[model samples]
Target: MEKKLNHLLADLVVEYHKLQSFHWYLKGYHFFDDHAKLEEYYDAIAEAVDTVAEDMLMLGFKPESTMKGFLSISSIEEAKNQEVTSVEAYEAVLADFKYLLDEVKGVKAAADESGDYLTSTKMDDYIEFFSKAIWMVGQEVR
Candidate 1:
């Protein structure tokens, strides 16, 4: 459970940076909407990052806090370039959301198996958020 939580934390951190990169450098039509959406994404990811780290602490595990630590464990790759089109940004965001959803589901399952109801229930919010994000961003990408 701790390991899953740590991986989730790493993903959240990398995803946060990706959102920031998109929010800052995306261009062309839909820039306003995409920028605002990316801002919302990063904001939510920031909250998740903090929550996951605290959750780890509560479970008597140390959360990985450094960028190097996050990069090492996170499956999500960093933004390839600072600038990206709205389509490219949306595609990347959609993919990350899907990946994180799966990761969270796995974490929830592990927590349930371990009888850690607190951690299991905690993942519910993340599951819902990522599902909604995938739908919303899917529309944009499509």
Candidate 2:
């Protein structure tokens, strides 16, 4: 359970960077709007990273803080230097949100198995946020 949360935290860190990259590099019809949205997303991801890492600490686990650690554990890969359209960025984020939502469900199940209601609740909050993010990003792409 701790391991899963730590992996999710690493993914959150990577997701924050990816969102920042998109916020800075995305170009197209809605450049300003998409840029602002990605900024908001990256900020939210940063908060999630902090929250999850703290939760891992509470569970007596050290969170992965280095880029190498993150890259090794995270399922989402960073796309640095590649030119991406706003639609493509949104689609990528939506896919990431979908992936996170799926992982969180399994984490929640693990938490339940361990009788860790607090962790399950935390994952519940993240799951809800990711579901909404997926919907919003999916809309932008569509």
Candidate 3:
């Protein structure tokens, strides 16, 4: 369970940075609005990353905190030199948000199996937040 949580933390850290890239690189229609939206997403992801790390600490597990570490464990891929429009950015973010929710759900199940209600409850908050984010981003892309 600890390893799973650490893997999630790493992936989220990667996602948070990916949101930064999305904010920096997104162009085209709805630039300002999209930029602002990316900001909100990144900020929320940052908070979540911190929360995940703290949870790791609470469990006496050292959270992986490096790009190499994140890259190894993250199911989500980092954007390289790809240039994409705001629409593409939204699409990518929406997809990632969905992926993240899936991971959180899996983690919640593991937490339940281990009788870790605290972690499971944390995942509940994550599911709620990301589910809303997924809906909003989907609307943005469509």
Candidate 4:
């Protein structure tokens, strides 16, 4: 795998964990509903992370799954046990998704730069899906 792809994959793992933390820690009047939705989003991101790792393995590169590796590569904020309101949680998720949109786009760009059309296409699809999901979250916040 290209170095850029490795960086992006590591970021995906970190962001995946952050999303999961949000799902687990999320609270408010809409706790049940919002939690469920967050779980769905987090699960999808976890699957995408797996796909990215597999791609790295297929390219003869070792996948980075360690916390240290994620910390080193991710631009996304780490998950913390901060108390947040429903609106805050919604906004945080929206922000995270927006960040993910950029990261996935960067992954796609790296793939293209490395002449890996397949990876580029896959990342592009993920970017589109996450972007729409972020928009949905934004609507919910409004």
Best by TM-score: 1
lDDT of 2 by residue, 28-81 (tens): 889988888899989988988888888888888888888999999899989787
List candidate 4 stretches off by more than 4 Å.
Answer: none
lDDT by residue (11-102, candidate 4, tens digit) is 67777777777777777788888888878887887888888888888878787778887788777777787756668777877887887788
**Per-model lDDT:** 0.92, 0.87, 0.89, 0.79
Between candidates 2 and 4, name the one with more favorable TM-score.
Answer: 2
Per-model TM values vs. the true structure: 0.97, 0.95, 0.95, 0.89
lDDT value for model 1: 0.92
Candidate 3 backbone collisions, by pair:
none
Model 4 lDDT-worst window of ten: 1-10
Give the poorly placed runs of model 1, Cα more than 4 Å off. Answer: none
Tens digit per residue, CA lDDT, model 1, 1-142: 7788989999999999999998889999999888998999999999999998998899899899899999999999899766899999999999889999999999999999999988898899999999999999999888
Model 3 Cα lDDT, one tens digit per residue, 30-58: 88988998999999999999998998888
